[model samples]
Target: MTKLIIQIPCYNEEATLGMTLAELPRQIPGIDQVEWLIVNDGSSDRTVEVALANGVDHVVSFARNQGLAHAFMAGLEACLKAGADIIVNTDADNQYCAADIPRLVEPILQGEADIVVGARPIRQIKHFSPIKKLLQGFGSWVVRLASKTNVVDAPSGFRAISREAALRLNVFNEYTYTLETIIQAGRQGMAIKSVPIRTNGYLRPSRLVKSIPSYVKRSLLTILRISMTYKPLRFFAVLGSIPFSMGFLLGVRWLVLFFLENGTRSRAPSLILAAILILIGFQLWMFGLVADLMAVNRKVLEDIQLRLRRAELNSNQKER
Candidate 1:
């Protein structure tokens, strides 16, 4: 039987939590059983009570506000423990149309994708400012380049992951799980696909992106960090090439000036600076090589970890 669990990571969302939960589908065609799991990230409000009252199958609570990334990871764990074969993650504010859950999980159910992301129509979202929409598009483009994937929506929270895919995901960022998870999925060679989906009318301003500047800053940092982590070679190579190219041109200029004008004293500083830049660039390139090697090692370790988790879960199932 295909067991599907829809998880919502909630904060102080007492007022909207009920509305979000009320619309969630209790049944889907391909899924034999559909369950709800809520992660309460230390909300000082009645988020926990609201979840329980909404008939949540499982609820994970944190002692304090641990942030979205932690809450998402916790929810994944709770879902796995509850014997969820597939996991769907959504926002508690009801930004996404809950009716699209079946569409989001369709790719995973058909074995076409290990993870499916519901891409919202950025231009159509009326609440989004022009700048926000542009930034969103730009961010998605950068993620596509960095992750080497075709995902059009990197920051989308509405997504579905198979049990296998969920086991391999690890969130290191404290800000948000949306971008990092996509990068992680891409780096780990998991099959990820994006489907066009519609969103509901804006209920309220996003709590995550309180301001445009803060959102851009945090989102860019997360993307860059993940890029450096997974694709260190590319990251370092690009950075190193700049200095190396400039140093080469400068050194050539110094050499030509010395040969033509015979000005050794004046060109000494230029030559020295050029050599330093060249060395710096070379060292950076070498650092990248080392980081790339370490990244490979990390991938190997992650594979082992996933295998161990699968074995443990199978053993637990047998005992039960």
Candidate 2:
């Protein structure tokens, strides 16, 4: 039987927890059973109590607020341990329409995708400012480039993952998991797809995004970090090429000048600078080669980890 567990990573969401729970569907086509799980990220309020009251099937609690990325990973860990076949992640603020859960999981259910992300209509969303809309589009574009997948909404929290995909995903950032997970999945060659989904009106300002500038800064940094991790060779190649190309051009210019000046070493400043830039560029490329080797080791480690996780899960199931 295919079991689907919908998990929400919540903080101090006491006011809207019940409504969000109420809107969640108890049944969906192709899903044998539906379960609710809430990750209480050390909420100061009665978030855990509310989740229990709302009949959450599982509760993963933290000692203190560890950020959304931590909570998301924690939830995934819990769901995997709890014998979930499919996992759906949603927000506690009720931002995404819960009724569209089926649409979000359709690709996975049909065996067409391992990861399915919901694509919100950013342009049509009235609550989004024009600038927010533009940034949202731009950010998705950047993520698309990094992940090498056509994801329409990389920041979307509403997404579904198969058991295998869940086993493969790892979150390195404490900021958020949305962007990083997509890049990880795409780079790993997992079948990822997007489906158009609806959203509710604004309930509260985003806790993740304090402001546009902060969001952009964190996002750019996250993208850069992931790029280096996933594609170190390409990342460093492009970065080093800039200075390398410049140094080559400068060296050529200096050579032309030297020949024009009767091959005199009197004007050696340009040649010295060119040599320095070329050395620096070569060192950067060397770093990329080392990093690429490290990435290979990382993949081996991840494979070992996946096997251990499977063995542990099997042991837990046997005990049950």
- Pick by TM-score: which candidate is best? 2
- Estimate the TM-score for candidate 2: 0.98
- Cα lDDT tens digits, model 2, 25-114, are 999999999999999999999999999998999999999999999999999999999999999999999999999999999999899999
Q: Which runs of model 2 end up more than 4 angstroms from their true locations?
A: 263-265
Residue-level lDDT tens digits of model 1 in 1-320: 89999999999989999999999999998999999999999899999898999899898989999999999999998888788999999999999999999999999989999999999999988888899999999999988877779999889999999999999999989999998999888988999999988898777788899999998999889988998898899899999998988899999999888888877457778889899889989999998999999998998988898899888888878888
Task: Output the TM-score of candidate 1.
Answer: 0.97
Which runs of model 1 end up more than 4 angstroms from their true locations? none
